[model samples]
Target: MFEKSYDVAVCGGGIAGAAAAIASARQGKKTVFIEKTVMSGGLATTGLIYIYLPLCDGYGTQVLFGIAEELLLASLKYGPGNIPNWRIGKNAEEAKRYRIIFSPASFTLAIDELLVNAGVDIWYDTLICGAQVENGRLTAVEVENKSGRGRINAKCFVDATGDADVAHFAGLDCPTAQNALAFWVLEHAKGAKWRLEGSIESVSMHADGGSIDKKRGMSGIDGAEVTKFILDGRAKYLARLKKEYASGNQSRTTLFPLTLPSMAQFRTTRHIPALYKLRDGEDWKHFDDSIGMTADWRKSGFVWEIPYRSMVPVGLKNLVAAGRCTAAEEDAWEVTRVIPTAALTGEAAGTAAALCADKGISPDELPVTVLQDALRKAGNKIHLEDVGLAPKK
Candidate 1:
């Protein structure tokens, strides 16, 4: 096996992984980003989940900032989406929410550009096979690519695999949740009047054979389960198209799938049971160690302070979890798994990893205030009051 070294090694290349790699590299660390596939934006781009949710509380204030906002704007650079002038103090109704619908391909290109600009060493089509842990600290990750097996030794690591692959590899206790079936595809339909500022339109098949149903769900962590989930989703998509054609209302030429999701659209998989798990009904709550704030994308006037403790996995010294694998449960998981919160937590984890590497310390050994200060200096609003909002009385 070949040997390599870096200051920070970010596992996974999705939205969270991209943000982590960029944040670490920007902090002057030698960072390497590893991805199992060629694409960058994970589910957001490859899974056809292209909506960049919201950055605002949905009432009238913008809550998320830094890389979350940067990626949202970047998503539109090569795609079709618009950001309302929310910075000018227009209300949500008048200015519209801070969100956009982007082309997945375009967002992939933009993410690659951002990664390159940040001086991140990127390894595409590389799969993480194992990890090396010593004295309760992660040391290096074993990976395989076309170059064969190799070991990437880093001072600190960020687990952004969405499925908690790194933490699981390190023998950490990771809890999982079932995901409802959802298959979103981009199609070209003749006279598709409700197109989303693009020539093509997105169509979805949900769990109950409808669109975006969440009742019946299944586990996504097992290998066979993943295979069946994908196959079952495709079968449902095929059934939908067959019905459309049989009705004599649409034909292959009139309406057909332009692109299918290259990855499974499972919403939640596995996550670390961190030091602090953000649970349901914590909306508008305050955390003294909050690294940043994220709004509830599903509804307006609801926000949550993301605790730095939530990213720190127990019994691990140099590893922090981000994105869907963070310590958020139930309704909180639904909020943190989206694009905005993924980037938010990704940036925080990456910054913390860099700080740990620089100081030759572990993630838990580092002070939360130091991490919070670094994040705030990078234009992130760490708490509710930082954005001129307060917890509900």
Candidate 2:
């Protein structure tokens, strides 16, 4: 019904886009965030990817803080005695595992409040179909809603559209790699007649609850059992889910079938050629631009630097990318797919876009130091020790 623009535009009202919009609005820039679905939290809400994932490094430091920390702490408050841990990493010297978990509904409300309080404009159930470009830079983007099609012009744009929808439409070469895939999920529950004692399992899915079926869906089966299974059996279930995904049929309403998100979720689609791409190499064993980090189940450890270049596409002066759509190898999707890391990058991208507006410069030439400081001031973690960019020992 309304057709207007702002200083900055971020597509994809998911965690990343929301963080970027909030960061920009907080800095006094008029910003707009767009989402194809309602209930702004993206994967966290609509997709049901409840776990925020990889919030900190191994040193017990939250490499990705700022709005990321704010959202998690707020969500964790609902769980009385059983909140997921937020401490990962040992110190600033080495990368550690991430310890972050959040509820879907809690995450949605928390960030929705952040955006509202900060005064970032957001549109839901909208899809960006194209972009309005000048000689090279994008001047405005074309979007479509249920009513009709329209346009939004902005000083700069952050393509947080997850699948790089905006950037690709703007003539940016967004190559969809075949290495990964994505899906949205909805989980239902059924028979709650399962128990785990002190031996192999200490938690019980059926202990104090009814069954996890339509018969028992109405019973007071909170999210505790889901968290327990994810934390303790992520590796196990991950494999099982992958193996049985095609054949695993129990009713989406059944407890066993309702195990994952409303539908299964996917973040990346394999190799993308941004100005920078996270290559599969050992030199990155210890990254230099490490802004945030994540560890995979205390096994093969990885801490990634949120690179300034990743946010800004190389050739597109006005366009930037964020969230699971950013540059990453297929295998690395697990790390960046998390909400906090994605939101941190979203924060960075938003900051960069606003910087372009303030300095009247291209996103490529926007002051990195200034953007870094703004992000740092906003409470995002940037690894200073890894400044040398050395391989890990």
Candidate 3:
């Protein structure tokens, strides 16, 4: 039985996993990142999602910050800015800011460089099959790779598997829903020819393939980014209709100008559930333990601070969830799963895990307020005061 160990072992090599591994290692933990695939940057990098959706909370607020944001910029820096408007075609300005949205291959390289520079021991092409728990502690994680089945042990473990695979296998309390749409990461091999009749931006979304949702709501948004604006706007409209007890019958919607690069891009799904959802109702009104903030197309269009408790799993002691699976109801889950928030949450989870390891304490026992304070001290913005939560258009 091939056996290896680390001070902290991070499962999943996606953005969250990468961020967590780097954060823990940066903080002086002997960290190892285990990824099932040869390439890193699971979704954003491997998935080839160039633009960072809702990086800023509604109202132009930057809710999540730190290494995650750094990586987002690093990835997006290769491309042009998000369309000028959060809504498709609407933000002609954003489309102009960035140039040549980068390929997923480039992103993989960037993430690899970042993690390697941070001194993380990354194991590629390795699949984690299960966990070995003893005395309420995870001694090692079972994995299978080209070499065969073996075990990788660690003092502290962070599950960046957006699906919360480790937590679920370890029998931890997690949110579950049957009909959640799987996020399909399609290859954008075919160059796009977006259809734009009259739009401020020069490009429009292609009617054929590509999954990036546009924000334009009025209709006729042929651009990926612009259309996501439409979809978000449409979702908002539906939510408003549902709120007013009115029928949500939409006859049609149009596409907006495409984002930069004249290429197809899409990533997202719906109906995903959460273990500990953070609703804007009484639960959130009285939430004292804030971890981060998020925004989506809903009544609460503004971003709200996420409580640290939300990040901490219900039963897991050494592990923490860092991506869309972190903890929020269906509605909130949709928004939090966005690239930037996922990355940021991963960063927080990783940072918190590293802090716990440094203090020789359990993640649940670590002082959350202290961790939040550290996030801010490290030039990571953590307040709604300076960074407003407005529509990022």
lDDT of 2 by residue, 1-393 (tens): 346778999988887898889888988999988887777777677666655455544445444567777766665554312233335334422222444334566567777778899998878878888888888888888888987887888998988877787877777666554311232232232333332112123222321111111121111112453344334334544444455445654332243333344322334432224766664442235444444443332233345665666666766668777787888664565566567767777888888888888777877787677776787677665653433323463
- The sequence of per-residue lDDT tens digits that candidate 1 reaches over residues 1-393 is 899999999999999999999999999999999999999999988887867888987666889999999999999898676776655433354226788778889999999999999999999999998999998889999999999999999999999999999999999978988777888877766555434565334442112232545556777888898888888888888887788899998898777787888888888888887999999998889899998999887677788999888899988889998898998888988888899999999999999999999999988888999999999999999888888887772
Backbone clash tally (model 2): 35
* Candidates sorted on TM-score, descending: 1, 2, 3
List candidate 3 stretches off by more than 4 Å: 77-102, 179-276, 280-287, 297-301, 386-393
Task: Give the 10-residue window scoring lowest on summed lDDT in candidate 3.
Answer: 180-189
Positional deviation of 247 in candidate 3, in angstroms?
36
Q: Which candidate should be chosen as best, given TM-score against the real structure?
A: 1
Provide the overall lDDT of each model, using Cα atoms, as 2-decimal numbers.
0.87, 0.62, 0.60
Off by over 4 Å in 2: 77-98, 179-264, 270-272, 281-301, 384-393
**Which residues of candidate 1, in runs, are more than 4 Å off?**
85-95, 191-194, 198-215
Worst lDDT window (10 residues) for model 1?
Answer: 201-210
Give the C-alpha miss distance for residue 238 in model 3, angstroms.
31
For candidate 1, give the lDDT.
0.87
